[model samples]
Target: MSQKNSEGKRSARERLQEQRRKEESRTKRKRTLIAAVVVVAVLGAGAGIAALVAGGGSDKKKTAGPLVAPQGATGKDTVTIPVGKPDAKSTLTVYEDFRCPGCGQFELGFRDTIRDLEAKGQLKTDYHLVTLIDGNLRGSGSLNAANAAACAQDAGKFAAYHDLLFKNQPQETDDAFGKKSRLIELSGQVPGLDTPAFRKCVEDGTHDSWVKKSHEAFSKSAYHATPTVLLNGKDVYGDQKNPLTPDKLRQMVTANAKG
Candidate 1:
């Protein structure tokens, strides 16, 4: 072969090798871009799920609706559901939302003791119904449930209905009490609470406004969590930043009786 032809062949080989290197570099860049996009998509999805769990779906505030105070309600917003007796020496105030799992735990844990104390006329409980979870969870279950409870109060079965509500509480993510019919059905578990008046009240959402007002009051208060309990106007769980055990609750009430 002539020297010029040989040199031309060598140059062609070099060009081919350079072309392959450039193609490989392009392929690598493309793969890197695709991997980066996948990572971003996964991160975005995770963020969305976290927002949902945190109840950040919408900007609209969660409210119980119009502000109509129930007949027997007391306190600034008339959202206070009274149990025990007016003249009871010790007052046990509770700030709670029906949709809150923590509140359910507290109720189930202390139901019997609370009833016993109330029965003995040693303790009176003021239940403040709030709708924070409804706001966070984006539903009307908390509001509806609170209204149904108020209706139960009107029917003279608040205590029974309260217990029943906590007993049948659904998962934190589920809006179980959003339907009025479901609330009425739940009332059946509480004797004498499934009357016509109670049914009408639940259906009409008579206490929705009251619940909203209660939630407003709750937001204004120093509390930032549900299942907040105060014994004789003092926080029962203040000493320990955790839930009060049955024994601790009994001890607190017993001490309150002495003072």
Candidate 2:
């Protein structure tokens, strides 16, 4: 009997040891799984942070438009014009807010002469667009208008389409046409355009980001007020820099050509 009791005690001890071993194994597995999850999470967070920083830096460098290799630029500089001719010695850049009344007046004053110059390839014009007001007229409509204008450029109707948009601009009221739809209609007014292609591209949000970047570039640059114009990368101001009439513009060009 003493031997049997001793045997039974030994068996009980072995069983207990087995259970403890099993418990320890389970604990180790749980710890391993938890450690693996934590490592994955940490790695994922690091990658995300790196991506955000990289994207932000790239955006600041671009300031506007997508990444473009420096092209048609003078020595030690880069020129970015998405739709215009690749090389132009003379450029006319405009900064304007869609809802600014002053800009509308400037457009009325200069559109005809600018058109003639553009056709003659004597000038390449760049538009830096902004939305001074939108919600009061139509919620975010001005922003949409600017974006659509950029799309028009992509569709090869920038100059004519630009005229159409400003010419048909609506007042601040309930009767105002919403921006996106209005742009579709305005596409038809652009001369020598494939309206269907333009309409489709605008609907797809093409050049929207470019428009935003152009606006940001203007804000970052030395330009002030709507219709701020530049000739050959030099700011044009006053009757001396920018002539008031076509004849004056022609004269200035002729004088510059002679020099």
Candidate 3:
């Protein structure tokens, strides 16, 4: 073969190789762009899911309707449920959550004594119900139960229903009280409390706004825990060095009465 023909063949081969290299580079760029698009799509989907979970998880914080305080409710913003004679010499103030185990224990331990004192017209108790557990544990049990208890208050059966609730409280993790049916069922135990009005009140969440307001009040206060018991205005249950007991509470009330 002639030298020029050999050179032409070599030139043709080099051009073919160059074309293949360019094609490979284009293919690699396309794959990279597709992978980036897929990654962005996956990330966008994950963000959407996170937003949905956040929105659904905070049901207890949803805006409540008009505030409707229960019957005979007193104190600031009608947030207090007053028990015992108003003219009683001593006053016991309690801040509690319906689903809080500590509040249940407090009620179980000191209920009889408190009732006795109330009956004797020596003590008036102001109860402030809160829903701290619902906020902490991500459930509506505390809010629902508090609203139902307010309905009982309207029926003039607050004390009995309140004691009954603490007695029959479900496990802290269980949201049994979140069900209106469960609350209405418990109300059957209290005579004259299972009327149509009471049922409607429980189902309609009549005092939910009021309960939320009470919880807001507690949230803004200096205390952070439930079962915050006080004698008059002095913190009684928070003194770790001097724990408050049922007998001690009775003695204190008696002394206050005598004084």
Candidate achieving the largest lDDT: 3
Clashes of each: 1, 1, 0
Model 1 clash pairs are: 66-209
Per-residue lDDT for 152-173 in model 2, tens only? Answer: 6565555676677778766544
What tens digits encode model 3's per-residue C-alpha lDDT throughout 1-259?
Answer: 9999999999999999999999999999999999999999999999987775565332433446899999999998899999999999899999999899999999999999999999999999999999988888866789888999999999999999999999999999987887788999999999999999999888788899999999999889998899999898999998989999999999999999998
Tens digit of lDDT per residue, candidate 1, span 1-259?
9999999999999999999999999999999999999999999999987776567323233333566676677876577889998887888999888889989988888899999989988889999998888788687788888989988888888889888889999999888787778899988888777889888888777777777778888898899799898988888754566757878777877787787
Candidate 1 TM-score, C-alpha based:
0.72
Query: Which regions in candidate 1 have their CA more than 4 angstroms from the true location?
Result: 1-66, 238-243
List candidate 2 segments past 4 Å from native: 1-88, 135-138, 172-177, 191-196, 238-246
Model 3, 200: alpha-carbon shift in Å? 0.3
RMSD in order of candidates: 8.4, 13.1, 8.2
Better-scoring candidate (lDDT), 2 or 3 = 3
Q: Which pairs clash inside model 2?
A: 64-213
- The whole-model lDDT of each prediction reads 0.83, 0.60, 0.91
Q: Which ten residues in a row have the lowest lDDT in candidate 2?
A: 69-78
Give residue 161's lDDT in candidate 1 (0 to 100).
88
